[model samples]
Target: MRKSRKLAVLTGVGLAPCLVLGLSTTPASAHGWVTNPASRQAQCATGTVQCGDIKWEPQSVEGPKGLKDCAGGNARFADLRDDSKGWKVTNVGSSTTFNWKLTVQHATSTWQYFVGSTKVAEFNDGGARPAPNVSHNVNFKGITGKQKVLAVWNIADTANAFYACIDVNIGG
Candidate 1:
């Protein structure tokens, strides 16, 4: 009985490291989002507007690239697609700066801004990591009036991108 007990303890100790290694923490998944000009998620995060789960995780509007939806097609944040939600419209001139608040900076490929199907501006980062706080000054050339601007942050290392939509009243 003593021999059997000793063997069992030895075996458990030997496997401990393997178990710990397997259970080692993985990298966090939380990514980035836009803040200034109050994207829907940003509005929720700041309590400027009421929202659902996105309110607690404004920086998580991630999904596959090449999507045009405001929520990045994330069903959990579908509330953002509701245009009648009375989203606060930011009054801006013909040109304004858009700021990005990255929760976790990733290697970026490009930053794109779209007003409807027309791309107003694009900045190529060439697979470079951006700072946590980034900003882009965009000119609304040939664009005006109330518009929903879709901002996409393409990650160079992943098949994903972070999305944001800022409602604005331009040249108002």
Candidate 2:
């Protein structure tokens, strides 16, 4: 019985390294990637944009972060026209270089930008032949903490209806 016990212990010890190696060999999923502001960490959250009118006020956030996946089976947007349908920035901290992810459901949809109440940028489909879903990265440099950032989807023929979700990193 002692010999059997020893053999079992040895077997367990021998398998430990293999188990560790096997677990370590697996590749991790890249759902969201952000740059860490401190330690010059390359991973962090610049910002996130969701579809619909923003109901909540923008909240400050810190640390490396990523936008959550769309919820309620509906895409999200920023600066929604309706007061009840808009996006909010949470855990926002002082940084620059906004990294955004935008997915347009309709080809006629366009993404509009604003700094506070002033319009800054506008992204249009530009009559792309194949009107399908597309992703875009928006960079807003020289952004201050007090300034408000807004992105909206303006549809051409569909009552300004479009869906968009974005994540931004504010570090260079």
Candidate 3:
């Protein structure tokens, strides 16, 4: 069997210089996390915040379905569970748009939005692959002050779901 290739090297001449490409051989196990208003993982992924190994694979925070915790119960990313890690909080108005960045698109079962233990909204995809740029405008009209919204992407074909926690100062 051939080994999985995570990196591909390429060389160019004349008009362009050499370039290196990063690739994932495994398709089913990779993809996605909330972005807009910037989820904790998104911030680490972009260098806007410092973190551990999660900084390299923010889209890989997959844990079993129905889990309520961020980092998706993955120990390597347990830093995401650190409430005092100084995650940058984005100030926003009500009815905020939650954007998802997909590194590898896959069939999705549902998208859930939550504030603490309270589920604010849910969108059922019925096991359909999502659009390239996935986003949802969730109503936050009744919510106020500092809150952490947990966004979950349930994969249709797997027992796992990707998790992200977005810190926000709602109604600010």
Best by TM-score: 1
Q: What is the lDDT ranking, best to worst?
A: 1, 3, 2
Provide the lDDT at 94 for model 3.
82
Worst 10 residues of 3 by lDDT: 6-15
Q: Each candidate: RMSD to true structure?
A: 3.0, 14.5, 10.0
- Which residue runs of candidate 1 sit more than 4 Å off their true CA positions? 1-22
Per model, state how many residue pairs clash.
0, 28, 0
lDDT tens digits by residue: candidate 1, 1-172: 9999999999999999999988896756678777778888898888888889999888888899999999999999998898998899999999999999887889999999999999999999999999889999999996889999999999999999999999999997
Which sequence of candidate numbers ranks them by TM-score, best first? 1, 3, 2
The lDDT values for all models are 0.91, 0.36, 0.87
Choose 2 or 3, whichever is better by lDDT. Answer: 3
Measured with C-alpha atoms, the lDDT of residue 117 in candidate 3 is 88
Question: Which sections of candidate 2 miss by over 4 Å?
Answer: 1-104, 129-133, 146-148, 163-172
lDDT of 2 by residue, 69-119 (tens): 222122231242223333343234343333322223334445555555555
The residue pairs found clashing in candidate 3 are none
